[model samples]
Target chain A: MRVLGIDPGLTRCGVGVVEGSIGRPLSLVDVGVVRTSTELHVAHRLRELEVGLEEWLDRTRPDAVAVERVFSRSAVSTVMGTAQASGVAMLVAARRGLPVALHTPSEVKAAVTGNGRADKAQVGAMVARLLRLDAVPKPADAADSLALAICHVWRGGASDRIAAALEKQVAARTRGVRP
Target chain B: MRVLGIDPGLTRCGVGVVEGSIGRPLSLVDVGVVRTSTELHVAHRLRELEVGLEEWLDRTRPDAVAVERVFSRSAVSTVMGTAQASGVAMLVAARRGLPVALHTPSEVKAAVTGNGRADKAQVGAMVARLLRLDAVPKPADAADSLALAICHVWRGGASDRIAAALEKQVAARTRGVRP
Candidate 1:
């Protein structure tokens, strides 16, 4: 399965696509950051993010999406923006009938590096090794996004199935095909 | 001028529309809440909010949108959802080319009741009195939304003009109509 991972942020949202599943070799499809101008109004910046995310979705057509789960414990100034960006990413994926998973930073680190407290360099190194890339993705956000995708591929088993089942049930009910 | 005010939340988003200028008597155009089931996925809930806000915009066609500014100091469990909802509200308005303003809670209270620290009841009572309503709008969220709209009417002066000017410049640039 192919997964698009997003490290959501207001000014620079990191995005990476990984193609693989559990117990298989993972390959990197693409990695980049969607940047928005700080000078723009928050509303306009969000609109720009939506446009950028839509373009990525259209280009990659990933089967699922993985986004970093934001926590309120972060810096007060940045947590809100992170949450807003994450919400937009999830909305875009759900709109396309794709299952979206949220992975905590620690969860992603543990999945990729076997250490929940792994630092940025360790996570980046592991991602590079796993994806067979010669170098770690630039911009910590990019590497973190890849780690999120890898985590989802490794730990998405039950959650992914449940989401898929729920989607199908909802669709069936909407079509009046099920009671 | 007319303004649509939103009290952003995950489960119940309060919305209010008011018609009047800074000094003139304000009248309530509409008041209600947009609700999404807690059982629904966060992504779907956001999409539902988008649809609900769109409907309100289509019906009210307000000159501006006012949304409560989200702060991270609130309950950790709810602040993220609030920020996400606020983002969606701003996006809907911006997408429609409408000027959007964010009013802090204290600002709304001060504008409506002459006290920044006024309690909810005080703010609600003033909203009713100013709008000439027989009773405060039901649901605290509804009253808060109306208060926000009232605040924007009274204080949207310089900020409103700036937003309008910026929007025009952006639109002109988009159309290649400017040097």
Candidate 2:
């Protein structure tokens, strides 16, 4: 199964895609960032993000989308913008008829680092190591995106290839009964 | 200037559009709604919201957009979805280069009614009288949308025209004083 993960923010969003088959771990397919300018009006900035997200979705077309859930913010401005960004992301995936799951920041961190208290750099290193990447994803956004993908893989049993193995078991059982 | 307010949610979103001029109270331009399937994936719901907001924008071309600030929610799922819906709304206004302002639910209620402690029904009745509409907005969402719009108008001012007026005042005063 192929999975896409998104880490949403007001000014920047991180996205990562991975693909895997049964009995093998998921491999990193691609990663990128969606950025918006604060210098522009709030609405225009949102439009830029919407357009960018749509463009990314068109190219990737993953089977599933997993996003980092919204968190509490002291500033209403930041909270509002972040919420809007997440919404646009959900909209894109939905338009494609893909399934979406939202994971909290702690959940993504815990899945990637094996410890919920892990920091950004720690999480980034873990993501790079787990994915067997050439190097750690640059900037926090890319690494975070990678981490989201990692979380999805774990949840979806990418490490164990449960879906594929389960398919094989059912097939064998059916065959035995026929004989 | 005409302004529209939106209170985005997964199951229900309130919408109200009011047209107003300088030195006069706002009048109802239109009031309506847009809803999404509860069974649909959250991301798909956001897409529906985007399309709904887009159509609203195209038809109204509101001079400004007002949205309720997303407050903290105890339910994780609800918070996440509400945030997404708000995002879709902001994106619509941003795409059009229109100014978007946000207000808290209490602020909207206070602005519409004389008290921030007012409930939905109180706000609805006040909105009906303020706009001189024959009936109160239906299904809660529409009324809340109107409240948000009223809040923005009271606080944000007629931003599009007011900004120009301020600029002209500054220019004239600066020129005469320099001479």
Candidate 3:
């Protein structure tokens, strides 16, 4: 399946598109950023975002989309900007009839590196290694976007197994409760 | 000067427009929320945000806009949504050609309750007393938005004084260093 991943930011949105299966090396279709300027007024930024995202969507029509969710800790201003960028991403995917999945940083890392607490560097290395790229993706956001896509692809492979396991656990709980 | 405060959220955005000098409430225009459904698709939510924000802007027409910053401790999904909502608010102000001011939670509470770490209830009581409202603004978001507006109005009075004070300090430091 073809999947697109986005690392949404107010100023720079990192995006990646890849084709592959679970735990498999993904063939890179495209990677880049949707950029807006701080110099522009607020309205101008949103317009720029809309126009840019539209262009990207038209150019790279992936089957599915994966977006990083925000978990802001500080800098309210920064959070506001990141949120706007992410909103644009969601709108683009949802409008285009694409199923968008959200991944937390930890989840993305765990899917790629087999560890939830893996840092950005480790995630980047694993992403490059998995894709068999000679070098790692530059600008952590780009790597992050790639990782997110790979995680989705990898997770999709075990969908049946995962679902069955979850069902079995639920059945066990039901039996335990009733008895 | 008039200041409008906003608590931007995906489902509900709380807005309050107030006109006042430093340390006083001159006039209160309105305080309320724009609500949306979480289950609704992204496009629908975006439309709701646009219409609601536009109405708030038309009704208030304040001199400035102030928004509470979004920060996250967990769940990336939430941060993304909140950020999107905040973006809508910022875009509206920017489109209207109004400058936006941001205040941190601590800053808002410090201005209203004389304590930076005050809770929502404490701030709401003070806001009720200050705005002379019969009851606390319904929904914590509304109260928070109103409190933020009051904060800017109260502290904005000293803006000029603070600016002058900083200027004097800079001049003194320059003179001392040069001598």
Candidate 4:
């Protein structure tokens, strides 16, 4: 399944799309950053972000959207903006009826690099190697977004199956059907 | 000017509209809450909020939107959701070309209750009195949202004028015009 990953930030949001599923080689579809001026009003900045994200969504239609979950323990001054950016990403995906997945930074690191505590360099190197790129993507946010997409492809498929199975089981029970 | 105030929350968002200027008696145009199920996916909840806020914006057609500024120092688990909800509100306003103002909790309280540190009960009481309502608005979020609108009308007008004056001064300076 093709997946779009978003590393959300107010001033610089990273977006990347990858096509693949678990146990398959991944191919890069696109990668870019959406930026808004810090000098603009917050409302205007959000509008810019929404427009940028919508453009990406339209140009690169993906099967699912994966966003980095914003942690509350981050820098106090930036947490609000990050969360707001993340929300915009999710809203765009949902408006399109696309399934959305939120993966923590550590989860993405572990999925890509086999180390939950991997540093940026390690994650970037792993993403490069996995995608068979000549070099890592520039602007760490872009690389991180690709890593998040890779992680979602590797992990989200299994989670979706599990959820589907549970849903089927619940439906069977509701209908008094034997498993 | 008619102002719409939004107290952003994931499960329970407070929305209110008031009509008046800085010195005029404020009138309650509307007051209500938008609720999303906690059991729903985060993306779905955000979509619900966006739809609800959009409906309110379309119905009220306010001149400006006032959102309560989210602080990271609030409850750890709720701050992210609040900020996300606030982002949706701001986006709707910006999309409509309506001015948006963010008022901190203390500023709202001060404007309504004459004390920045006033408690919820005090703010609620003041909101009722200021709007000439028979009773304090049920649900503290609703009252807080009205207070935010009131605060923006009283404070944001002056701030907006100052900002406009500064812009004109900078433009004159660029043209080498004497003040």
Candidate 5:
């Protein structure tokens, strides 16, 4: 499946698309960032983000979207901006009927680097190695986004199957049936 | 001027529009809540909010938009949701070229109740009295949204003028001229 990963931020949102599945070699489809100027009005900055995100979605048309989950441990202002940007990404994906997955930073790191506590440099190096690139993608956000996409491809399908199984079990229980 | 006030929330977003200005009796143009089921997917919930906000903006065509600024003191999940909803409100306003103002809860309370520390009951009572409503709007979110609109009408113009003056001063200094 094709997955588009978003590392959301107000000033700069990272985006990357990867095509592959489990036990298969992944190919990079695209990687870039969407930026809004801090000098602009908050509303205008959001509008710019919306337009940029829409453009990316229309151009890539990925089957699934992966977004980094916002954590509350960050400073309030930073968290707010990141959450807002994440909201935009999710909204665009939902409007297009694309399945959206949210992975924590640690989850992405573990998926890509086999270490939940991997630092940024380690994650970047691992992503480059996994994608068989000459070097890690420039600008950490871009690498982070690519890592998110890789994480989804590696883990999202299994999670979806588990959820479906649980759902089926619930339905069967409601019907007084055993599988 | 018409002002649309938004009390941003993930599950229930309160929206209200008021028409008039300071020194004039304000009229309630509309008040309602946009709700999303908690069981819905996160992306779907955000899409519902986007649609609801777009509908309100198109219907009211308000001259300006006012949103309650989210604070970090709240639970991380709550803060994230509120900030996301606020982003949608601001983006809708920006798309239509409407100026957007963010007022803190304390600011709204102070404007309506003359006390920054005023409780919700006091703010609701003051909003009812100011709007000449038969009763306080149902749901504290709805009432708080109306109060936000009232606050903007009463204070936003002066603040806008102040911002404009500051901009002019900066421009003059850059040009090496005095007003």
Candidate 6:
């Protein structure tokens, strides 16, 4: 499955696309950051973000979108901007009928690395190694987005399997062939 | 000038329009709430809010828009939703080139009533009195929205006059005239 991951921020929003499924090698489709100028009004900044995300969605057309869940307790000053950017990201993806998944920063770290408390360098290194990239993506936000996409793909596999299993059981029950 | 004021919320977004200038009697154009189902995903809820705000802007065609400023420190559980909703409200207004104003809850109270620490009932009563309405609008959100619009009109008048004076000074300087 092709998944798009976003690390939402008002000043700099990171976006990346990863294509892979379980038991297969993951490949990086594309990655970049959407930056908005501080000089612009907050409303205009949000408008620019919306336009940028729409372009990304149109280009990649991912099966699912993964956004970093913003916690209000993290930073009092930036939490509102982060949350607003995330809301735009989710809205853009859902408008296209794509499944959107939210992963916490720790969750992304845990999925990409072995530990949830992994540092930024460790997470970047793991992402580079997993995607077979020559170097870690620049501007921590880019690497973080990739990690979120990878996490979604990996976790989404497990959930899809469970759903398929449930469907099979339901189908069998409808046929009076419960096993 | 006409202003549309919004009390941003996920479950019950308050919206109201007021038409009048400072030193003149204010009239209530409309007041209502836009609600989204809790069962819907966050993305869809945001989308619904965007649609609702767009409709309000289209129908009312207010000269300016006012949205309650959301503080991250307020109500940790619902702050994110408030920020997201406020973001959408601003975007809708800015996209149409309408000036957007943000008023804090305290500022709204101070503008409508004499004190910043006034309770909801006091603010509601003042809103009713200021707009010459028969009764306070139903739902605290509705009343709060009118209060915000009224606040914007009262405070926006001061800023607008200052802006006008600045423009006049610039024009006079260009004509080499001293005042």
DockQ of each: 0.38, 0.26, 0.16, 0.31, 0.30, 0.21
Q: Candidate 2 regions off by >4 Å?
A: A71-80, A106-122, A157-179, B73-77, B114-117, B153-158, B161-179
Across B25-89, the per-residue lDDT of candidate 4 in tens digits comes to 99999999999868666776787788788778878988878999998877667888888999988
Q: What's the C-alpha lDDT at position A55 in model 5?
A: 79
Who is ahead in DockQ, 1 or 4?
1
On a 0 to 1 TM-score scale, where does candidate 6 land against the true structure?
0.88
RMSD in Å for model 5: 8.4
Alpha-carbon TM-score of each model against the true structure = 0.94, 0.76, 0.64, 0.90, 0.88, 0.88
Candidate 2 achieves a global lDDT of 0.72
**Candidate 4 docking classification:** acceptable
Using TM-score, rank the candidates from best to worst. Answer: 1, 4, 5, 6, 2, 3
Using DockQ as the measure, the top candidate is 1
Index of the highest-TM-score prediction = 1
Please give, for residues A110-138, the per-residue lDDT of candidate 2 as tens digits. Answer: 98788988998899888888889878887
Candidate 3, residue B105: how far the Cα is off, in Å: 2.9
Pitting candidate 2 against candidate 3, the one with the higher DockQ is 2
Could you give candidate 6's per-residue lDDT for residues A1-179 as a string of tens digits? Answer: 99999999999999999999878999999999998767565766776787788778888989888899887776569888888899888767755556777888898999899899999999999999999999999999999999999999998765444433443433332233110
Better of 1 and 2 by TM-score: 1
lDDT of 4: 0.83
State, as a TM-score between 0 and 1, how close model 1 is to the true structure. 0.94
Worst 10 residues of 5 chain A by lDDT: A170-179
Candidate 4, superposed: residue stretches over 4 Å from native: A158-179, B159-179
* Per-residue C-alpha lDDT of model 3 across residues B1-179, encoded as one tens digit per residue: 77789998878788888878864445678999988756554434654575677777777778777888666544566665676877767656654545666678899999889999999899999989888888999899999999989887766555434433433433332232210
Model 1: residues with Cα > 4 Å off, grouped in runs: A168-179, B169-179
